[model samples]
Target: MAITSANQLELLQTAEAVAREKMIDPGLVVEAMEESLARAAKSRYGAEMDIRVSIDRKTGRATFTRVRTVVEEDELENYQAEMTVEQAKQYLSEPKVGDVYTEEVPPVELGRIAAQSAKQVILQKVREAERDRQYEEFKDRAGTIINAVVKREEYGNLIVDVGAGEAILRRNDKIGRESYRPGDRIRCYIKDVRREVRGPQIFLSRTAPEFMSALFKMEVPEIYEGIIEIKAVARDPGSRAKIAVISYDNSIDPVGACVGMRGSRVQAVVNELQGEKIDIIPWNEDLPTFLVNALQPAEVTKVVLDEDAERIEVVVPEEQLSLAIGRRGQNVRLASQLTRLDIDIMTEEEESKRRQAEFEERTKLFMDTLDLDEFFAQLLVAEGFTNLEEVAYVDQDELLVIDGVDEDTAGELQARARDHLEALNKAALDRARELGAEESLISFPGLSPQMIEALAKDGVKTLEDFATCADWELAGGWTTMNGERVKDDGILEPFDMSLEEAQNLVMTARVALGWVDPDELARAEAEAAEGDAAAQEAEA
Candidate 1:
């Protein structure tokens, strides 16, 4: 390609056209063209030679030059890429190291192959620029709805023609029972914009909960204006969905606004989802009240919340059990997701039976372990003392408040509880010793007799084994034999150690066994001292 002045103008015009068509900056197109021309020039000038090209932005004038840097004789690694100060004097008056020189060269005639290579280079550059532009445009637009046309389908995934780019709607992200054909207009949530080697892949989703929330935001002006807020959403996808909304303005009902006039707003969303049933319920701060609303259309007779377990036991009338549970437990499952709590739906009869069983179990435990009569065990169980731990920990004053339990009786009961625990600990220690537990592990600070026995049972019988134990392993992060993690139901076995206590025990064992360097121990002591000083200062 000869760069005549007229042809130079054509080159600039071509760049401008391609930039406008590709939605990229014209300067980027010019840079690509320059790079392509430089690549072509290298073929004529020899690949080892330093060649550079530039095109004037205003004048459209093209220039090609060979670049060389002046260097000491010893520094001239490549003769074509560098020139010695002695050789530099041939081209310039001053000869110095670290100086650059440029010599203009006449433009070369392009061979057919060279021209094609240059064309490929410019196309690749322009394609890269376009991908980057699309990525920048859509990356921040994730979680928002975008309208597109179905351009084609591949492997059950739709290629959507979003303006200036193409997006992918995977089969799994499509609403159940929804179908699309080529050129079909569709709206999808922009799930992600990923930049890959091929191009930016914009993923779209129709069944995402965020998609439903966004639809409501579009339909409800109050939500858009922040007068109403969507607290949570749970979906069975295409079949049914529930959304909890709260209102900031006292006069505005959030659910009513989301439902719109005679359910027009929600119906629009439902139509878009192919008739998915939607339940719009008002959000409540009280968990029990919120659970009742979540289990809507089902009457809840009572709710027993186990806060530590993050579970709720909902007792319903016999007739409402199936309704509360829904078909195949869908109602309670969605309610759990919406409220972020596990919901156990039960009939009143089941709850009554469970309560009675629990009462009997606690009574038997007290009667057997505390050596109490059946009546006394029942009395303690009735007073809400579920376990010996509670009996041992409760204040004497609180125990005295129980019916028929004077201060002397409360004291005697606590002593007996302590005695039982001590006997159990002594037995555990004996068992641990029999299992080859080291005296060092038994005497380790922060290790209780029960912990020692647990460790011995698990084959962690030595001081080194105790030192090597991770805090989570020593505390409560173990998965059960059934492959389930020890959850809030309770800590298991050796994992019953508190994190702080476990750390202390591990560090003490490590130091006692010489597993840690003395310098590290000193540093740890200094850090602990500093931490304690800072804490004392904060308290002050």
Candidate 2:
């Protein structure tokens, strides 16, 4: 509609009111109004004309203009938007070919349909501005706690009224047994903030381990002050959780600070968590020590760690096995997560039986392979000789150091060990050749003789097989005999290779076999050609 002087003032006031209500700048609202008016004006004026509208921020007075650019006579294409330089000079004293000129056009009296269209445009702009405002307000608030009142429920998700915004708490993010009614005030962690077509969506979570850590930060002054640091946290939301904390100040006990006086600090956190039991443990750099603390209230008899496998074997008293494992293995599971290690729990009885079995197996292996009697085999086993490889590789002096073994006896043992290894290698090579193992694979720089034999046994007898083998397979793969995925000790049959060594061997095989991507090879050739060309040009 036509804007009278009174209506202009009313428009400015309306724009300001909407801007304040929507938490957006007043200038943005006025700009939206200008665009809406311009869109409506296009209907009255011909749509082919370059039309623009501007609203005075203070006065709310609207101005419409028809825009045209000066161009050379030959360059003039659209008469509506471009004019000849000679024609442009008629409007100005001196006109350049690139200069723009605007002529004031009377504001159109918006008809019923045009007014409705303009109103929709303005509302859409306001909605968009509100979404942008919300996104900017909440994006940085992710990973922090926020207090909100439950506004509504849709399906299982709770819509909560956060300050100046609304957020959704999905069912999966809520504590298992917790329920909320409308208008219930609750605290939750801001898990995510996403900008969508509808608006900015703020996602809240009460089940995240970080939520528990945040609550501890809020309740424990030491953590907030940075005297005590929360190292890691593992949670079974609404059931049980464990937190590892360390103290920067030597005198301050991190666990004690978290526990608070008379258990007040921890109790505050526990109450917030819907009574989820929390175990506060002091963190140690030593993994085994930290694991012992993580499996609290369960006495650990010994901890055997396999660093390469990132696993820990925890042996406890027979009576303490259930305690260490917890009800349904929750205790060990949480400890594993907290320590970032795979944990296997066993009782003293089980460990003892395993040790005895291993001892007997080794005794038999030495007797059968080395042709040693039971007495000599037991003596070698007691001296920590586990296998033929160690016996063959150790210095002759090492053998002499064993009790009841003289220099002559050590010499005979060493000769037998060497001879046995040589005969084994000869047999393995013969078998590998029969299996069609490629000469290139056998002679590859890093593939040990034993590794070549292992490859043959595992059906990796060709260069392509060596190239295509996955890193895990090359590194001996997992131990699957027990119906569980367990780490191998890198002893793949006749060879023991480290993961790094295995990776290098695999890469070498790939390069030798030209199994790498053709595109990468092409790129490398192109790079080399360019480098050579540059060098020749420099010399010339």
Candidate 3:
């Protein structure tokens, strides 16, 4: 029962307590120390020496055994004296130079080595266990907001202690007009949790799009409940941002709700972000409306959309041009991003100049390139004939009867009129189709594809065709399939037309035929009917 002093007992007890605190296995620590002591003893006592150490944990006592290998001859100085066959038999039945015979050694060497080895093993295990624990602690906390204190500045970024880990908040995440000092407390959204060689690494941001979004979720019940949706966000982080919001409930005003009363809701978010300005704009599908809203504080008079160019020409009053364009063009620049358009801002004066240039170009074409002779051109010009359609679609007979023309001239004018009139009429019909007039008319039963195609091809493309076809058989005995007679009332519905509508369409057709006075066609038809009635009255 050789018991060591109290100092030796204290050392061993401290080692055990440290192993427990650092979560290191006490058995592993003991095994590592034992291996180190055995190696140290062999080095000090010679390679052929065998040393065994035993520990008395309760009494803190340690003992060592020493042995020497038996040899056939004295090949090395440290080897035991060459044992004769009789000597080897007395010591061991079978002993070789590579094998050993043992005896108890002193406790001093084992005690000194065991204590040093245990200290080294415990320190290494503790470091590794701390690292593992930190990684596990931070891994579960990713994507959560955390409060942190600024520790120091490194490479223009803030090193913050976020409870279980150290986080880096980059410079760009700081508000433009706001800053932080060491020891300041701040709230940040956790962006990432990563493992590093030293410890758990966390990344934080205060300017991420989701930071504002998360704040809104905390402040607004609708956002948390998913009643409002943030469709898009264009942020000049730390200064201003445009958030396009939409409501899932039509009855709700998304922008108003996000803005809150007196802007308390959005203001809360802005305060968290250090008074960064936020604009909550309602999302609109209409490009013009959306662009107008995207450029806030700047009123737009008109937006000329050039979709093919992927640009819009915005006209603002002379005074508003600078405001709309913003300082350094930032207002329009952000608006362009928000609406996804290339905006060209123009003041009223510039726009007026553009319109004047266009007007002059068109005037030159009409005056110089148009086929009308100087005298007739001047007459048409005086009559406000800025476009050829004015003359081409006019009533040819009416123009021929305009006091100065004879029968031959009238015939020639009529021929020219017909050519131009048909061209203009065909162009108008093409435009109407483009404008969706054809789809609107397609549902009428009598206006079947075959009939419509026939009329379109025959140049009977107006409701005037109804008048011409009044005597023409539309179906069996002039009765269409709907049992409607080929009278005006009967055929109007098929074409989705009324009598007045039919008359107007005929007038348009007549004008396109170079008949300037469509009213005369109606008069001629009425006179023809009156003469027929008079002839019938005489016969009766």
Candidate 4:
């Protein structure tokens, strides 16, 4: 209706200036303002009228354009409509059927409604533009560390001012033993960034596994140069962590390099993690050995591995079990994560028991075929001779050197030992007959009658017969005669006494069992009597 005051013109320029500052498309701002003006115009001044608003950048003034659709003569209530083409053609040269004309509407008709609508539209456009800008700036920073200032702490979460905007550092992501005050300079890992209604929201973390890796890269020069690679890292946050490092150059010690001078490098990393203990261990190509090292501070005696199963059984002393497993199983748990292997730790006692059981099984097999005393059996055991070949390999001097043995005695022991050893390979029943063992030997205390019976039936009839039995098949079972008895007792002990007291018994049984061959016992006795007579004759 009239020229507006300076304030009205300033409002138009303010919108333009904000649009420029935000780098929004100029057309978008114009569209927003026009929509706002139209809403206000329709509500304030009746819907019958048309309204258009424009801002003159050069003149800084407001202008409006109002138009009406061309309709037929009967459309009298169409306050925003004009005459049809046929009527307009009488006053003008070229008028189409639907031709409409425009006229300027006064600004007074817009009133307060248009102003409010215009303001809302401009604000909406600005917010959308800001969100787009923030997204573009932050999306590329994922997985990288960013330096920021601590704005403040809200409910134990750090609100970091990462230049572009505030990023959230959740309580769990905050290092356990570290604190930062407002305006403190800090570093955080960019876990994620997402565009939200307010702006680009960033998620930052201080306790991430990658954070430890990044710290190592900064502290260890070898890591930065790529000579040593961190294969994997597992952390217990504030308390402890395990890092598996490998050297591409074998000459360079991966563990030593990561540890640095007196652990200065790792210590630095630990300090940064707020005193979390860090273990820098060499990563082994062999998973079993690698896992052994991973569960450190615990000494491993043996590593039994199941390659196809991807499992490792590590045996350690009972004293080291707690250390290897760590408090609350932290050490082994971290090792599992680092090596990706299922790890089992056993104590020395366990492995020892297993080995002892195995040794007993072999001894039982040898004892199954021959009747022998415990002392004689143990003498063979003391020589580390578990089987016949071991016995055959021993020399006379070696046999004599066995405790409680002399040269002549060693000779006898060797002869009897070999006789017993060779008989294990005989057919089971023949072996039993050779050793003078019967179904009765199986029924003795501490002897497995069923096992002895099985051995006898299998043609392993004597202690020697049992020795050659496969260790797998030599397992002793319970019997009604003797519960959980050893197979060795049933097979090896046929004589009632020692070599001294049992000489006559040995002689007799050897004859009865066919062990001395036909009448050789009597012939040996006669030969001994003759030798004694000749010695007496010589003395006279």
Candidate 5:
């Protein structure tokens, strides 16, 4: 109860034992005891008085003190804690305001209620220290795999003991309903380590693609030693997975290294993942070449990639269609994920039909706009002319390359195409006016008549509306919703407007309407350029 010589050393001994058991610093436990004793002293010596406590680390001695501060007369509120400078003369010769005065005080005998309160305070502090230690230990361990013993299962989620703390493996994070009972040792990827109100939560996942990468790294010494790098991983969980690997040394084949001698390395990883099938493919810098490899076991005839859209079209043989698509579209889906591109697969016959359809459509457009015969239109389409604008604006030399096309015929073709385009422009302007397109937007410097008509039809009729639009809203974008990428069609996207062009047009509109200052815009752009340069330098 009291600070007697008999039990003075008991305090330090208890702090050491608790700190050792909790795997925390003994200083933290001592600090908690100091705070708990201070609270007890405050209860014993009037609650209004300021009480403090300090414990000696060596001798386990407790020192109690009462502290009061000298203050101005008007600021003197607590008589026991704060005092007027004039009244402080009894304690010191020339006490000035803002000075603290302390006197030794006797340690209090703890009542049953006070002892219980002190115990609770120490327990709370110890718990907080333990949580901090756990978070510090596991925070950097995220993104790596760990072997843990299953502690229990809650609502289909597994709680595993991970040496220092417990980690949760969510039901969705497990591999294809693979269940584990208590005391079962499981390997999982530490997906995240987060500190919360309750404690630090370590989220583990066996279904994460990184888990497969880690497994390969463990099974293949080439990967662990950095001779081979895992470039990408896509998983169908317990069913199948694809990993792309690249070797830094020319002598080593990354895929062969991962497969090991007679399939020993890959078999080890597959067994750990509940018999998940893995396709090890070589990584390539060329995305199209890599994609052909990713959709492996299925031979591709041709690959047409649209870099701007991050989409690729693969033409395969009719016999390979089913193999490329796989059951439930899993093969193509994994290939898409591995390449980070949206893939559209078609048989060679389907691709030929598509090409024929496009050719007929373009030939028809030339016939209608250029007033040419079907044979002449077919000749134009065969010469790589897809639109009337190419005919109207192309050099005469380009048209002369066509067979049986002389100078006079080329002139006639261009004249008719120009006349038709002018008529179309006039009709678009008239339609825009009918739809309430303002002159402020119509007379804008960069927008064409067709662009104005499109904007008017989409309710972006005024200059103010155009100025308020975002670049992506006008140029279209891909958005990730729930995991899959969804396309957003833009008003100006049909005109093939790029995001940068949309941004420039919108900024020009803002400047013309007195919304943006040109000088400030220049300064901001300069600062942005400087920031980019600095970042590039740092990265280099």
Candidate 6:
């Protein structure tokens, strides 16, 4: 084949046809053809020679040129493509470094080998351009739903053609081993669109909680219009799911709107999910109230939440225990996921037994340490005094309010509690020292003696060790590993150390050790305060 006068426009026609077929820019296809022609020219002339190709966009006329650049003697490396300024002077009136000289050349005839190579190059470039076009079209479409045609199954993953391109629905992403035949039309949530080496990989999912939310948004007008917002979703894939929604308009009930008129809207979503049971719960600002809603179909007798620990305990009647936990713990697991909290569920009798055990333990602690009788300790516990610290630091008026307690008795109780707490602190400090805690860490302002002991046991025995710690390392936090949240137990977590508190202590240690500038800290604090004030003003 050759770029003959009769067939010159063939290149333009082919480029336009390929671009239209692949849905890519026609110019990109033309550029790919030019590059392929240039490579063929290089193979014919000489590999080291400078050869370039350009095609007229409108006329499809191909131009071939042999070019050389003038460079300094020391920089001239490619003998065929580059020449020194002195040598370049022969070709021009005044030659200068970095000047390029080009001359028209005869187009070469294509051989069997060269034509095959050019075809491969054009195909590769077209594939890349197609991938880029597909990615640009779908990148912003992630987290939304799209209609697709089932193309084929590869290793249990569905390769569905989504009009412009193909996306993968992994085996795990399919709900309940769902199978589809070729040419079957399906809808899927665009979980992610990533640019990979071979091409842009579009990951589709039906099991993601967001997939259900997307379905609801599509089915319910209120949700689509932003009148109702789906705040949280938890799915057992094909089995069951829980959704929490809130409505901005008081006239519209979020749950009722999501459920639709006689469940028409939710039923559409349910059909898509293979009849997965959905519990549309109204979102509550109160976490415990929301939890009660999340654990639906089971009457909750009580909900005790530990906000600091991000955990909640629910008490139910004996008959509801099995229902609340669901078949194989599915209900509770989805509820936990929906609430973003760890949950502990028990029957009311179990809760009562646990509460009695805690009361007995506290009573025993007071009896042994404060040197009080069982009856007095029970009275203190009944009045909500749980530990020696609370009793020691509480006002004398609080003690006087208890039955059979007056000024003298209150004073005696405070004195005993303070003495016992002091003794416990001393023992903890001594144990910390034995565990190799330095004076600097022991004297750290924010840490208690028990906290110091805990740190010492964990090898954070020095101020330097404490300063090098991350806030999350000192205050427990959750980590998502392999799609599950795992707790990272902190050394000082048991002492009720928050991340903020840990940060303050670490910064203080750094300042004391001359590692941080006090003036800089003050400036930073002032700047932060100013920024907060500005943000507040903007909000107002």
Q: For residues 320-354, what per-residue lDDT tens digits would candidate 6 score against the true structure?
A: 99999999999899899999999999998998999
Q: For candidate 2, lDDT tens digit of each residue in 379-461? A: 89889999887888788888988888998888777778778888887887888888878887787776656777777877887
Given candidate 3, what's the lDDT at residue 162? 72
Clashes of 6: 0
Residue 34 CA displacement from its true place in model 6, Å: 2.1
List lDDT for all candidates, in order: 0.88, 0.87, 0.66, 0.70, 0.94, 0.92
Residue pairs in candidate 3 whose N, alpha carbon or C atoms collide under 3 angstroms: 393-511, 393-512, 394-514, 394-515, 394-516, 395-514, 395-515, 395-516, 396-514, 396-515
The number of clashing residue pairs in each candidate reads 0, 0, 10, 22, 0, 0
> Which residue ranges in model 1 land beyond 4 Å of their true spot?
370-373, 389-419, 439-448, 462-540
Off by over 4 Å in 4: 1-113, 197-199, 220-227, 249-253, 260-264, 307-310, 354-540
> Per-residue alpha-carbon lDDT of model 4 for 1-540, expressed as tens digits?
223765566656766787778766665666666667665666666677766677675564666677665666676456554667566776557876567677777665444655666678878877777677667878998878889999989999999888756799999998777899998998888999998767788999988889899888888888899999999998888898899899999799998988888888888887777889888888888877788788787898998886533467889999999998888989988887788666888899998898788667656644653345666666667567666555555777777767777887766655665676546434443544554565534432333333344556556654444334332233322223342223233222331212233244334434444556656666887999999999999999
Ranking by lDDT: 5, 6, 1, 2, 4, 3
Off by over 4 Å in 6: 532-540
Score candidate 2 by TM-score against the native.
0.89
Against the hidden reference, what TM-scores do the models get?
0.86, 0.89, 0.49, 0.54, 0.95, 0.93
Q: What are the runs in model 5 whose C-alpha is more than 4 Å off?
A: 517-540
lDDT of each residue in 158-258, candidate 1, tens digit only: 99999988999999999878888898999999998899999999999998999999999999999999999999999988899999999999999888888
Residue 162 lDDT in model 2? 92
Question: What local lDDT score does residue 302 receive in model 3, on the 0 to 100 scale?
Answer: 94
In model 1, what is the error at residue 420, expressed in angstroms? 3.8
Q: What is the C-alpha RMSD of each candidate to the true structure, in Å?
A: 4.8, 7.0, 24.4, 23.9, 2.0, 2.3
Query: At residue 531, what lDDT does model 4 achieve?
Result: 100
